[model samples]
Target: MGFTSAWSISAHEDAFITELVPCLGPLIEAEETEPGARERWERWQTSGVDDDLVHLVTGGGHVQRLYRGLTDDDPFCVMDDVWGQEGVEERLFFSAFSKDWAVRGLFQAVGPARAALLPGWCGNFVLTSAEVRDTLPRIEEALSCGPLEKADADRRSGLDYLPDEESVLDGPLRMWRLAAQARIGLCGVSLVLD
Candidate 1:
């Protein structure tokens, strides 16, 4: 069964510990200089992130606010992925590349093919995590029975039209707005499903 309608995610104190610790692993790593650096670093290097944790970096305060809301309990001391209003995507991409490249470099440093599975913690899962794999059957069941999932899939498919090659590459902020809205919207959907 698949997820059909959005369910409520209780904003509880332990939600971050159970749900978001994996999602914020990268962010926690990027801000290693902050206080409580040691624990945050260790968690980032060890936690396994699932695919349900969609990476959404935004410039507006909304994204940061969302992160803050989720992490308020433990105050995950990480750099807010929101970097002003211009370089959000660039920063996120760079951070991702840095982690992936650093892992490969570590492999090169120690020995060939030794650094299996990126050494540190898992970032975001793709679409094949075991939890998600199991969850999807339930989700499918829900989707088959309800209208929520079908409606969202249809909506997102429509959004696919907005971020094509010509439109996004045509200008800067033009695509930025579209991309931001799409990302935020999708994130909301994911949270609802979760």
Candidate 2:
């Protein structure tokens, strides 16, 4: 099984509840109106509602844990499941772009040429709004240049690297656009790996 990566939009708990939740409530309600959605909606509402809220806004997978308590001084233990850790809770999980695609396709296509970008080495990290804003232009430029070439390994494995066909860049591009929007709104962009 491969790891999936997504851009998560997060903010302090007060901001999330007051600012972002209202914006998403209508959308979540509308989605629930669709057939076969009631079960998922009820499940989300009853158990792990915060995670449900995150899934609702960013359109990503379940986020069992969100915040790190103030007393947790260790930066490496940011995801501890302590009771007070859920305070800074305005987080939203977004797209699930594969790690393989990020390293082999997107980074290779847009980063400096010949750079050995390794997906496995990229653990979860946060991207500030400013960082997201700065990177958007480069990614957009790369996308505008046209479809990217597949990794050499994919090519060697007899996979067709068609420029006109769908490539690995599609998912990340969509996620980046969303991240850019969140960045413009002054939200923190975190890259979560699963």
Q: In order, what is each prediction's RMSD in angstroms?
A: 18.5, 17.1
TM-score of every prediction relative to native:
0.20, 0.32
User: Model 2 over residues 31-134: C-alpha lDDT tens digits?
Assistant: 43544345543554455343333333233311212332223462222243211247433233233354332233333343322222211111122344455566
Instruction: Output the lDDT of residue 105, model 1.
Output: 22
In model 1, where do residues sit more than 4 Å from their true spots?
1-66, 69-128, 145-194
Model 1: lDDT equals 0.26
Q: Provide backbone clash counts, one per model.
A: 10, 0
User: lDDT of all predictions, in order shown?
Assistant: 0.26, 0.37
Candidate 2 stretches greater than 4 Å from native? 1-102, 105-124, 142-144, 147-167, 184-194
